[model samples]
Target: MSRPESGAPTTTPPPTPPGESPAAPLPAAGPGPGAVAVPPSPCLSKVELRVSCRALLDRDALSKSDPCVMLLMQSRGQWVEVERTEVIKRNLHPVFSKVFTIDYYFEEVQKLRFEVFDINSSSVPCGPREDDFLGAAECTLGQIVSHKKITKPLVLKHGKHAGKSTITIIAEELSGNNNYVELFFSARKLDDKDLFSKSDPFLEIHKLDDDDTFQLVHRSEVIKNNLNPVWAPFTISINSLCSCNYDRLIKDQPGVALWDRGASLGRDVPHADEDLASGPVDGCG
Candidate 1:
């Protein structure tokens, strides 16, 4: 090739082939080497949970703990109990055969809690409060679904046996179905505590919260001068009702409370008693 003057322009590259086009340019480099790549979590439909305990603190004075597991889910800023396992008598290491089924929403951060209690007397039906406290564990559903299985130690921190024992957790995902519930309730022969021999009464339904306190979920209209009252029918999603668990307790308070007024029951008006009867109906109809 002959030498060109310094002012002369350089030669252009050759054109593309007849059928093929020019190669596209590569993209610019991303962030520096410090940038890390994260894998996306899998979306799951449902999950199954199996609970087991080891070296759990025995609440009973003279016998091994009859341990049972209770599962709770967080919803609406409150943790609601959903399921429970039957007590395994006198076994420090109890493998609950009862598998709990819960719907897993990948988009939502579903928080879960587990509590173990020691049953002193299996002959009688008692609430969690009556049962002896053993220990508890907490985690999110996504954590289990992502890993497919998780085992964690349970921590005990209460009473004279505080820091005395601990437990473990095991979880797995499974198929699930959409759950719903229809509820009906009625009261009979409610005591009339008013001075006029008749009282305005309404029903207040409460669901148990994580703090072992009852949170009001629903309320019925006030029925005037009626000893017997029937509430209107209603339907609710299982998640909203009790996180799809039926073993949880649903509390009902039936009485009249004058909030705006100065007088109130058990406060200014001395002690008084009232009896109300209520139960769930068989079906939505």
Candidate 2:
């Protein structure tokens, strides 16, 4: 098992985030879920949101529509704007790279809204006359996280149709712990598991618990058609990784049989052609 490299220069974490300063203190979304706001005394979790649109209305007559998305949250009848996505030019189907992070609590219901717009100029315009409207969607933060992903049709101000436009939202929860570990790893000379293509491989980080059990802490994204894969570096909280115990056993193995490990990094599991072997511990040995 590898320990997080220590004493590396790092920026100090902020004391507490400067949350939105609403005009007036809004009440908690009770009885019903509401806005760029979310849940209570509440169990806490951080959620990362990603948005994509498909078959959107093309507002521009000269070319494909230039589209952007605005995220709003409802707080007990008040709507607060949370974040806005970058405008994608000349494309009807655009997968935005912007990520929205929000606090989640288990006690209360949380609401969310997405407003997609077609930008006509440098400055963003609003209202029906401005005619920049494309489509909008509303749902609860709980719903999106429960489904892990959701797709809903964009609607006009009052549930009116905005053509065939639709939006897809994906949600991922982050570890809530403070201490973290950063890892960078790669592998070479992996076995070829596919007949027509190169192997697709990734890595998994598992923590050995006090009960003599292993729990998965992290998994790298798959890199396809490559035997020599240099996976991207990732940061994981030490609490989730091993309860802040570096000496605790960690499994940083390639996706393969545990016996073969470092030498057999190939494909992921559940596939017909799974990884041929496993990988190394400690580091990129």
Candidate 3:
């Protein structure tokens, strides 16, 4: 066929056959090559990060270092600890079950730091702890969720060179299944730390918030003189517990000393100095 006097636009479809309605032009094709590839959708989401460490150097003399991992996020040019995993006693390679939930903003570069500490004595729940420092790793939350799982070598503060310590992380977006958990927690033979009477032990349940603060969700009654006590069952929202995320961890810590609140016998009463009548616990429960 002779070339048309004018070239028709190549992008336009061929004219439809007569008596046939032109098929609706194919929906606009997706961006072609060199067309600035559309960046991913703005990632405003809730994600749970699970962490683990391997090949950690033992900081203890007698046994392996009791290691726990703390996760800190960069906030206003400063890194603040958001959450930490439970201490794994005498284990060089610890797979922490603690899941750190956080809000992911793709627009901003969200920096993160994972620090490993040999928690010999101090057992603070969250960051800025006074414990033996092991090593750390730094990365952006975007890096983690992008790869889904990543492994990075551990280093000292300020990215100082360190040994074979390394950490692995896995990221997962949260689901919308909101549920509550009914848990009955108890302590068996708690340590005694009293001068005059049995230790008064109670439980303080805490929830980690988006602002990186552990807010006290509930407090159990103080059970006096009972070392192994069964606390009443409690109901906590799964969302409150861990934002309804899967595979969350439950942590336990030693309760602080609460002096025995009991009646002191008068001098006339020949009662031993240790004889402390536990005060009425009617209101305690």
Give the per-residue lDDT of model 3 (tens digit) for 1-285: 665345332344679999998864343456666788767878588887878788898888887777788899999999998888766666787766456889999798999999898875534445335447889899999999998779999888677655888899877666676576676666655556566766556555545544554443444555666766666886765654565644443332212222222332121111111222222222121
Cα lDDT tens digits for candidate 1, 1-285: 977567544455467689988754343455557888776875666566656677887677776667778899988989899998766666787656456778877788899988888765442355755447677777898887776456666666643333545544444443243666677666556666667556555554445544454433444444556666666776644544454445663333212221111113221111112334334422224
lDDT of 2 by residue, 35-108 (tens): 33442356888877878899999887777677789999998898899888766666788766466888988777
TM-score of each: 0.43, 0.49, 0.49
Give the distance in Å from residue 170's predicted Cα in candidate 1 to where it truly belongs.
Answer: 2.9
Ordered list by TM-score, greatest first: 2, 3, 1
**Comparison by lDDT, 2 against 3, better one:** 2
Best-fitting candidate, scored by lDDT: 2
Q: What C-alpha lDDT, on a 0 to 100 scale, does residue 194 get in candidate 1? A: 66
- The C-alpha RMSD of each candidate to the native structure, in angstroms, is 15.1, 20.2, 13.0
Worst 10 residues of 3 by lDDT: 264-273
